[model samples]
Target: MGIFKRVKHMATADTNHFLDKMENPVSMVKQYIRDLEEQMGQAQQALAQQYWNERRYEAQIEETTALIMKRSRQAELAVDRQEDAIAELAIEEKLRNQEKLALYKTQHEATKNQTAALLEQMKRMNEKYNELVLQKQNLLSRIRAAQAIQASTAALQPYDMDRVHHGLARIEEKVWQVEAQAYAGIKAGEVLNAAPSYVEQEKRDEIQKELAALKEKRGTV
Candidate 1:
């Protein structure tokens, strides 16, 4: 049992390490952006529905206002005709419609306020999303610069001073021999010219310039 437990623990540790290695910051940030986009879409739908509710309340309020006015006029006409029961019924309906109009107005105002709140929330979320995008860009730029620097550093490592000096010594000897031959040919009335040797310093300078440019692009310098 103890051996089995030890094996299980080792397996778990290895799995965790593998999972950690698989986690990429850039991919994670992109996924977060996608999630935010989905949420924004849902929020927009909710806002649209809220606006619909506000409109529905406004329509109800208009209908209630018209009913109140109609009931009031009906009550007046019934009184003029000496129909007391009809007048009473119209007055009751007028009062009921007035109450409904007030309620509808209150509901409409609340819906409008909720819509505004939703708009503000969406504004804040959009701002946050933009900020995350900027951060992701900066992170990517830095990663690329780091990778370039690492490769350049590795390439330079093999060309250390000892190796460089040894290589230069051989080239210098070869150049000296070439010069001696050229001088001998010249003395014999024959001109001999050798092409220039490769310049390692220029290549080193170019690599350095490339590194500096990458740093600048990454905003590190």
Candidate 2:
């Protein structure tokens, strides 16, 4: 009866609602599983006891049937010997044995039925406990998945577009400064290469003088 009461609790419990309300659903579910196992153990013990009782009743019935047979034989022997009083007493004992046999048979049948019912109940409870175990595994998987999603979301929450854009802007500024320095160095090299040396200036002056002299000689001729 107590096991049935606990099984009723298991059957009526709302796992989803219960987990939703609990701060630690996993631990609570573990405890619930333990309770169910304990109740199942008790039920197994009770069923075993019922089976023992059924066997006892069967033995009693067998013993009573043997007694009935023995008394019948005694009555027949007494009648054959012409012992009228012994025959009557034997008949009476046989009738009492018959009554006892009937009672024992009835008890045995009743006990057998009781044992069967208990076995059915235990089978049902085992199925329910297995169902709960599967449900617990599913709930745990879902809980772990949810926790993983939450962790990923929390880890990414701090990186807003503004911060990302600011970092990119800094990198771009550095690149622009490098480009400007390179361009300044190239321009300085161009200026230094375009300037003429003193020897080249002197060579230019001598060429101009020779051209002027040639022009004057041609005009005189």
Candidate 3:
């Protein structure tokens, strides 16, 4: 069987049914492309063999034709020498050669036709295989793009804005509490540092007594 016949069989198959039966369409397409490549290789080998067979048949035809011509000349020479027995023998040989030549010619024609047909089939198969490869790549790209979109949509679907807002508010409140504590510590430290010394307090009391005595002298005690 030739690859073309197999390709024809595939062409007639129900593609939608096949896809429905498959667990993964992408993997199936990949496998189909591989099969096409393998078939193409086989088809090439078969085409080469057909060509060789055609050449062999042509060589046989040519050799048989030469033999037929030689035998005919021998028969003519025997008849010219007046040898009936020899002439009859040469004639029989010529007839046999003619029959073989006819058979070879028929085989050559048939082989030539077959070779041409196989070559054409192989050419078509190669073209189809290339087309399938391109289609497989495009399909894979589309599948990837669809998966990415689906993933992105899934990520967005479960988002919780309220939860995020509550978390942020809690963090802000903690920051404010830390700031207030820091400010209170700074104010307390400043108050402790600003307390009066003992000498400064005694000078303040002496100034007050002098102001009171001056007031008494002025009869304004």
Error of 2 at 145 (Å): 0.8
Alpha-carbon TM-score of each model against the true structure: 0.62, 0.68, 0.70
Off by over 4 Å in 3: 1-4, 10-26, 147-159, 172-221
- On TM-score, the stronger of 1 and 3 is 3
Question: Taking the tens digit of each residue's C-alpha lDDT, what string does model 3 give over 1-221?
Answer: 54667966654555456766888876886787788778778877877888788788778778877887887888789889988888788789878878888887788888788778777766766676666677668777988999999999998897698999999999999999999999999999887776656567788899998999999899997
lDDT of 2 by residue, 70-128 (tens): 87888899999998899899889889888888888888888788777667777767777
Pull out the clashing pairs in model 1.
none
The CA lDDT of each predicted structure is 0.78, 0.82, 0.79
lDDT of 2: 0.82
The residue-by-residue lDDT of candidate 1 on 24-97, one tens digit each, is 86776677678667667877888999999998998999889889989999999999999999999999999988
Output the number of the lDDT-best candidate.
Answer: 2
Q: Which candidate leads the pack in TM-score?
A: 3
lDDT of 3 at 65: 79
